[model samples]
Target: MFHRYLNKVAVVTGGSKGIGRGIVKVFVENGAKVVFCARGAAEGEALQAELNQSAAGSCSFLSCDVSQEEDIKRLIAHTVTLHGHIDCLVNNAGWHPPHKATDDTTADEFRDLLNLNLVSYFLASKYALPYLRQRHGNIINISSLVGTIGQKDAATYVATKGAILSMTKAMAVDESRYYVRVNSISPGNVMSPLWLDLAAQTGAAAEAIKAGESNQLMGRMGTEDECGLAALYLASEATFCTGVDLLLSGGAELNYGFKSQICS
Candidate 1:
């Protein structure tokens, strides 16, 4: 087992499933004691147990609804109380609601998404910064490829993700004095439960999935494990990296025109 992160302590939000879960798994596999949380207790507990069985490090689960300020605060405080220090803070808790045009999206929906997808990141970092400063730890915010290049009919989701990227840069600057790095990963077409759900939402699920796969120049969607590896790189290596938005898009944004036109 790799001991790259042995004895390190990491706090991951929304780690019960999807990309967040992948990040937690990678950290534990690399020997980082991880404290992860999600809104679903059953899933979180199951993941905690599964990882602890064979992980080089160890992990624990906490029930947290990241949309709530208290929950974010409690998650960070509980991790520090349990481990005494934080080596990494992965603000991965977020959601991408069904696609909606700007005219169709309600103000309340936008605000709700902001609270869950953007504000939670801020609150988690605000609470974890003190502990991270002591250990010179870093932060990895899970953003989206759409955040950089806009997505059609997904204005609300894009807004939140774009904000996260900006916030990551600002925080990176502010935290440099304490040696606490901040970075973001903008993933494109990652095949996770969330992505599957989004695909299924379309009337033609199979076609939607195929189109998503074709969007990437690689002609396939990315995997959760890939996201995990990227997070590991940011946390364990990439020492000189801060205020950077790493794109995990499988080269989806490389060319300008339709995939058929570009490839053909």
Candidate 2:
């Protein structure tokens, strides 16, 4: 699959860990030179070394806070300087401070969610437009099932992802003239480090993972590799595909009330 991407240059935000890391790994294995950014310099640096050593793909890390416009600009600029041009952009960096009721969510938290998840995606796409147009590249945004279905106690996070879906469509339509396709991937519960951390923090790790798995028709959460494959399909194979939200939620969508059954 990656043999098709040899020598191509790609940018993936929030690439330090979790699904973002998986996406980076897939791209590099496919022969793409990658520039991945995250705010955690230590983690990013370590991952860069590991990737360089193990994968045949060339990778570099940038410690850029995606919430800031200047930082995003620097990330894109740095990628151009190192790789000469950008062939693909993956907006995968994002965070959620657990689902909370509207009354429980602070204004500051809401703003942060929008800044990091929604605005950053816009800024990255805006800055990468030129390079992407040049190569007729593609943009793949990492959204969530919450965006489409909407979730209880997750207003802010859901809103941001919902916006990404809309943005993907709008950008795709506008960029079609330049042959720069834009699409999105909406993943369901997965066993990411973040999910692991959530379990530790809430003492619900085992329970949550167990419930998510049992709820799915496949009897398990989706995998990073699964999302990676979906991303690659959109980024490379879907020439006519634009503005589509590829739902990689296993069969969770099919059995809507299964999750509630666990706690009930």
In terms of lDDT, the best-performing candidate is 1
Model 2, residue 58: displacement in angstroms? 0.8
Clashes of each: 0, 1
Q: Which ten residues in a row have the lowest lDDT in candidate 2?
A: 255-264
User: Model 1, residue 86: what's the lDDT?
Assistant: 94
Q: Write the per-residue lDDT of candidate 2 for residues 216-258, one digit (tens) a residue.
A: 6788887777777788788878888898999888767784463
- In candidate 1, the residue pairs with backbone N, CA or C atoms under 3 Å apart (3 or more residues apart, or in different chains) clash, namely none
Error of 2 at 149 (Å): 0.8
Q: State residue 68's C-alpha deviation in candidate 1, in Å.
A: 0.6
Over 4 Å off, model 2: 256-264
Error of 2 at 118 (Å): 0.3
The estimated TM-scores of all candidates read: 0.96, 0.94
**Which tens-of-lDDT digit does each residue in 1-264 have in candidate 1?**
457788999999989999999999988999999999988899999999999998899999999899999988888889878999999999998999998878888999999999999999999999999999999999999999999998888999999999999999999999999999999999999988898899899988899999999999999998888999999999999999999999999999987865242453
